[model samples]
Target: MHPLFADRPAAGRALAGQLAVYAGRDDVVVLALPRGGVPVAFEVARRLGAGLDVFPVRKLGAPGHAELAMGALAGGGTLVRNDQVIYSLGIGEETIAEVVAAERRELARREDAYRLGRDALDVTGRVVLLIDDGMATGATMYAAVDAVRQRGPAQVVVAVPVASEQACRQMRFVADGVLCLRTPSTFFSVGQYYADFSQTTDDEVRELLRRAVTAG
Candidate 1:
C-alpha cells in the first residue's frame, strides 16, 4: 500500500473508477470546489465523459480560531452556519456578519476569475457530483451541497479522495450519495494523504477549466 495518493490527478482517477456507473450519462454533471478540487474533478469528468464546472464555497472560520469553521458561504448568496459552534463559542451576530461579508467578496472574486463572464452550468434536474480534494471539518462541502440543493438537482453526490470518518458520516445526511476513497481512522489532514499536495494556484485552476471546456 502506498503511503498516500501520488497527487490530485491520481486521486481523481481513483474516484472515477468508483463513479463509472455515471459515465457517459447526459444528466450527470461534475461540480468541483475551486482551487484544490478542480484537478481531481478534471480527471473524474474526463473519465466519466461528463461536463465539469466549479461550485465555489468559502469557509467562515471563527474570529480567533481560524481553523475552527463556524459556517460557510457559497454562491447565490447562500450561507450556512453551524449553530452549535456559534452558540458554544458565543460568536455574536456582528462577528458572523463580518465573516460572511469577507467570504462573499472572495467568493464573488473567484467566481468571476474562474468563470470569466460565463454563467454557471445549470444543475437543475441533473445528477450533481460534488468533488473536493478532501474534507476535514466538511463545512465547505456542506455549504456546496446546500447551494446545489437550491437548484433542484435530481440527486447530489459528494465525492472526495479522502475524508475523516466523522465528516463522511455527516455528509451522507446532506447528500444523496457519498464517495470517499479513503477514510483513515487516524486522520490528520487532507494534505497528509497526498504525496504532492501542493497548493493549487488560481492560474492552474483557470487553465484546467480552459482545457475542460475545450475538450467538451
Candidate 2:
C-alpha cells in the first residue's frame, strides 16, 4: 500500500531493525553488494556496530533482455547460473562466457574504485551479513552468498529490505539466515516499492566504506 522505504538509507535502517540481534557483536561483519547495497549496509553496520566492507558482484543479464538475469559472477570465480533461463533461452556456452568476461571487467573496476586500495575484509570464522537493496531473481545475491561461503565465514546471512516471494524462499537454501523485510507476491520490481530508488554511485559507496572503516 504505502511506500516501503523513503530511500536506500531508510531501507537500510529498516533492515538494520530486522537484524538487531547482531548488534554489538565483534565477530559480525556487513558486506554490501555495491553500489546500491552500500548505502543499505552502511546503515545496518552503523546500527549494529559491525565492520563493513564491499563484496563486489556483477549480474550477467540475458542478452537482448538485460533485466533478466541468466547468471552472476562473484569474487573468487564463484558463479551461479539460472539454468532455467539459459536452457529455455537456448543461451550457448560462448554467450555465457562472453557475459562473464564482460561482467568480470566491470566487477574488477568496481572493486578497485570502491576499495581505493583497501584490501577486502576477511570473513574467516566470522558472521557475514551479506546485504543488498533488494532481490529479484536472486541471481547476484546467490552468487555473493556462495562466494562468501567459500571464505569460511562462521555464518552467512542474506538481508534485504524487500524481495519477491520466490526470492525470499530461494535464499533460505543459500544462507544460514535470510531476512527479507517484505516479500510481496505481486512484486513488479524492487524499485516500485521504494519512493526514491535513485542510482547509487561509486563515490557514494566509497564514502560510506571510508566512514565505516574509519569508525572501526
Candidate 3:
C-alpha cells in the first residue's frame, strides 16, 4: 500500500470515500481547519453534499522553530499543548503564553477573512466532520476537537488523509470517530506524504468556500 498522495485534494478525495456513511445527511456539516484543511475538506464536503465552513485553528509554533508545533489554539478559546515537547524543550509558561496570544490574533483574522461576513454554520446537534489535511503531533486537531465539543456537536468525527500512528490513537479518545486513510508508522511530517504540498493561499480558501456553498 502506498501512503503517498498527489496533493491535498487527492488525499481528500480518498478520505471522502471512507466517510460515505455521512453522505447526503441534512444534519451533517463539514468543518475544516483552515487554511490548509479548507482544500481537503472542500472535497469531502462536496462529495458528502454537506454544508462547509471553517473552524479556524492556529498552531503555537515553538520559539525559534516555527515549523515545530509546541501546541495549538482553536475557536472557543481552546488550547492543547504537548507537555512532553514543552517540558523537554524547556518551554516556559511565559513563552507559551506569548505564542498563544499571537496565534489567537491570527486565528481571529483568518475567521474573518475566510468567512467574508458570512456567519459560521450552526453545528449544534449536527454531525460535524472536522477535517484537517493531516496529523503529525495532533496538537492542532486535538484543540479543534475540544473546541467543537464545546459548541455542542452531536458527533465530532476527526477525519484526515494521513497521520502518524500515535496521533490517530490520541484522537480516537476525544473525537466521536476518527477516520484516517493512512497511518504510516514512519511518519515525520504531514508534508512528507504529499507529492505537491504547496501552501494554500487565503484567496484559494475563499474561492473554494464560495464554490462549496454554490455547489450545495
lDDT digits (tens) for residues 110-207 of candidate 3: 99899999999999999999999999989999999999999998999999999999999989999999998889889888998888889999999999
Candidate 1 deviant stretches above 4 angstroms: none
Q: Going through the candidates in order, what is the number of backbone clashes in each?
A: 0, 0, 0
Model 3 segments more than 4 A misplaced? 1-3
Residue 147, model 3: Cα distance from true site in angstroms: 0.3
- Report RMSD (Å) for each prediction in the order shown: 1.5, 0.9, 1.3
Rank ordering of all candidates by TM-score, starting from the highest: 2, 3, 1
Query: Which has the higher lDDT value, candidate number 1 or candidate number 3?
Result: 1
Worst 10 residues of 1 by lDDT: 1-10
TM-score of each: 0.95, 0.98, 0.97
Winner on TM-score (2 vs 3): 2
Report lDDT (CA) for all predictions: 0.93, 0.93, 0.92
Deviating ranges (above 4 Å) for candidate 2: none
